[model samples]
Target: MTLDAPHAASRPTTSDELRAIALEQFASVGFAGTSLQQIADAAGFSKSSVLYHFASKEALLQDVITPAIDQLEVMLDRFAGASDPAKGRARFVDDFIDFLLRYRLEVHTFINQGQSLRGIPVIDRAGRLIVRLSETLCDETASTEDRLRLGIALGGAAYTLVAGATFFEDEIAPADEIRTALLTVVTELLAPVTVATGPRTDRNQKA
Candidate 1:
C-alpha cells in the first residue's frame, strides 16, 4: 500500500482509495480549496460515495492527518527508546525532518490554513500529539524549555524544508537533498549542551 498515489482496483480498500485521492487534492488545493466533487471525480466515485466513505470534509481531513500523526508517534516512540542520547537525538531530529519531507503537502496545507484548520480542533490536537511525542523524545535530558525549543525547531525545520523543496526543486540535483539540508541544520542547532533559550512551547506541549 503506497501512500504516494491512489490505485483503485477491486481491492476492498475503498477507504484507502478515498484517502489517497483526498490527500492528493488537499495537497494541490488545500483544505478550503478542495471540493468533495473534485476528489470523487478524480477517484471515479460520486460525491455521495466519497461522503459514505468519509462523513464530511472535516472527517476526510481528520483521516488524512491521523496517519501522518501516527507516523510521527511511531517514530518518536523509537527515538524515545534509543539507548544513546546522541544517536537518539540525531534520529529524532532527522526523523522530524523526514516526516515533514514525506508529508510536505499535508504539513504545508495544515500550517497554511492553521487559523481555519484550528476551528476543526483536530489540528491543534495533532499539535499536542507532536508536542507529547517531543516531550518523550526529549525525556529527562531536557527541561520544559528545552522540549519547547526542540519542537519549534522541528516546526521551523518543516517550513524550511518545504520551502526549500519548492524553491530548489528544479535547481537542486536531487529531491532528498532538501531533507539532508534540514537534518544538517537541525542536528547542529539541537545540541543539548547549548545554552537553552526561553520556553519552546512547540516542544513541551502539555501531556
Candidate 2:
C-alpha cells in the first residue's frame, strides 16, 4: 500500500525524503543489509545530509517500523477489552491481515531479519504481542498439545501471508473473499476440542 504523501509544508524536509527512501530500501534488503550511504544516494542527498536528520542507521530503522508497531499495539489493546474471546480473536486476525498487507515490507523485514535487532524496544514489543496472541488463542488452562497447535497455526498463518503476498497480488478472487477464506481456516484451527478420538486400528483389522 502506498504511504500518504509527506505533510504539506512550504516544502518537504530532507528528513522526510530520507525516511521515504530508507523505508523502500529496508523493505528491499532489510536493516542489516542496508547502509546510510545507500539511503542517502537513493534520496539524492549526501551522507551528511542524511546524518543531519538521523544519527545512524539504527535510528532510521526505528523510525521506519515504529508506526506499524504502534498501530499493532493499539489493535491489541482494543481487542483486550472485548468480552468474548472468540470474537476478539477473529477481530484481531482481520485487523492483522490488513496490517500485514499494508506494511508487508516492514513485516517481511522484521519477521525474516529482525534477529539482528533483538532487544530493541519496538521489536521486543512485537514479540510480546505475538506471545500474547498465542495466549489469547489458548489460555493457560489449555492442554500443552492444544497450545502447541494454536501456536503453530498462528505462526503458519503469518509466515504464509508474508511470504505469499506476491502470489496473492494477482488474485482471481476479491480481497474480501480471500480474507474470509483465510479467517475461516484459522478459526477452525483454533476451535476447542470437544471429543477424544480412539486409537486407529490397522486397516486390515477394520470391521
Candidate 3:
C-alpha cells in the first residue's frame, strides 16, 4: 500500500510528487470531482507549474496510471507463455496480488471511475485489457462455474484491497499480511477441483 522508501530524503522529483498527489486525489475523490488546482495545491506547486509538468488534468491522469497498465500488459504476456495451467494459475495469483498492492490507488481510481471516463484512450485501453485478462485467464473451454470462479476470485481481490483500505482504515492488517491472505484465498478459489472418474451410481436406480 505504501511506496518504497526513497534512497535520499529528496530523491523524488517534482513530477513524481505531482503524480503521487494526483493519484491519491483521483482515488479518494472520483476523477470527475478532483481538479488540477486541487492537485497543484496539495503538491505545493503553482497551477502553472503543474500544467508545465502535465499538459492537462487528463494528461496528468495518464501519467499516473500508465505505468500500472503497462505492467499489466507485461503480466499478461508472461501468463500467455505459461504451459502448465496449475502452475500458471498459482503464478498469476501471486502476480495479481502484487499488482493490486503496488497499484492499489490506481486500481481503486479506475474501478470506481472507469465507466465515467470511458472515452479517454487510456481508460478505453484499460477496459479492453481487463476483458483480455478475463479471456486469457478463463478460456472458452472452461465451464460457467469455472468462469464465475475466475471472476469472483479476481474481482473480489481487487474490491477487497481497494475498498477494504477505506473500510478498515487504521484497523486494516499490514500489507504483507493482507497480501499473504489474499494469495492463499484466491489461489484456493482458482484451484482445480478433483472429480471422481469411477462409474456413477444413481440412488434412484435399482441395483
Candidate 4:
C-alpha cells in the first residue's frame, strides 16, 4: 500500500516533512514493520535528527495521525446531538465520505495497523472514537438490521477507499468518481426499507 513520496520541491518545516515521511512508511508497511531508522533514511535525516524533532517513533506516529483524530472528534461531536435520524444519517454519510477521502492514508494506517498498536494511547483513542461514531449513528434502541446497515455502509466505504487504492494503484478512479460511487452505494444501504401492500379487493362488486 505504498503511496508516492511527497515532492521534494515543497518546502514544509522539518517536523512536517518528517511526519509526512513517517506516515507514508506507516501506511505502506505496517507500523510494526517500519522503524525510526527507516523513516530517517527515507527522509535523508539521521536517527538523532529524527529524534530531535520527535521524541520517539511513537511520538512521530502520534504527530502523523493527530490531525485526523482531532477532526474525527469534531465530526463526532457535531453528529452526537442530531435530532433527526434520517437527516443525521444522510449528513453523516456525506461528512464521513469527505473525511475518509481527506485522510485516506491516515485512515489506512488506523484501519490496518491500529489493532496491533492498541496499547499506544493515540491508537486506543482512535479506537474509542470509532466506537463513539457507531453509537452516534445507531443508538441503544437501533435494530440489528439498522446496525448492520450502518456498519456495512461505513466499513465498506473505508475498505473500498483504503484497500481500493492499493488494488487499483495507478489505474484508480478519480477522487470525485470514487466519492460519487461511495455516496450512491452507502446512501442506498442506509435508505429506509419500504414494504408494499397488496392490491385492494373490490368486495362489493364481485362476489
- Measured by TM-score, the strongest candidate is 3
- Per residue, candidate 4 scores C-alpha lDDT tens digits across 1-207 of 334455544658888889989988998787999999999999999999999999999998888898999999988777766898667767877887899888878887886677799999989899899888777766665666777787677666666676775677764687789889877887787664542246545679776
Which sections of candidate 1 miss by over 4 Å? 1-14, 42-44, 119-121, 133-153, 160-166, 169-171, 192-207
Which is better, 2 or 3, measured by TM-score?
Answer: 3
User: Pairs clashing in candidate 4?
Assistant: none
- For TM-score, candidate 1 versus 2, the one ahead is 2
lDDT of 1 by residue, 1-207 (tens): 766446444455778888888877886677788999999998999999998888999999988877777786688678778899778877777777777878866776566556677768668877776567666646555765566667566666655554554766744446677667767777765655444456556655676
Q: Where does candidate 2 stray beyond 4 Å?
A: 1-13, 141-207
TM per candidate: 0.67, 0.69, 0.81, 0.79
Worst 10 residues of 4 by lDDT: 192-201
How many steric overlaps are in each model, in order? 3, 0, 0, 0
Clashing pairs in 1: 148-200, 148-203, 149-200
Who wins the lDDT comparison?
3
Of the pair 3 and 4, which is ahead by TM-score? 3
Error of 2 at 131 (Å): 2.2
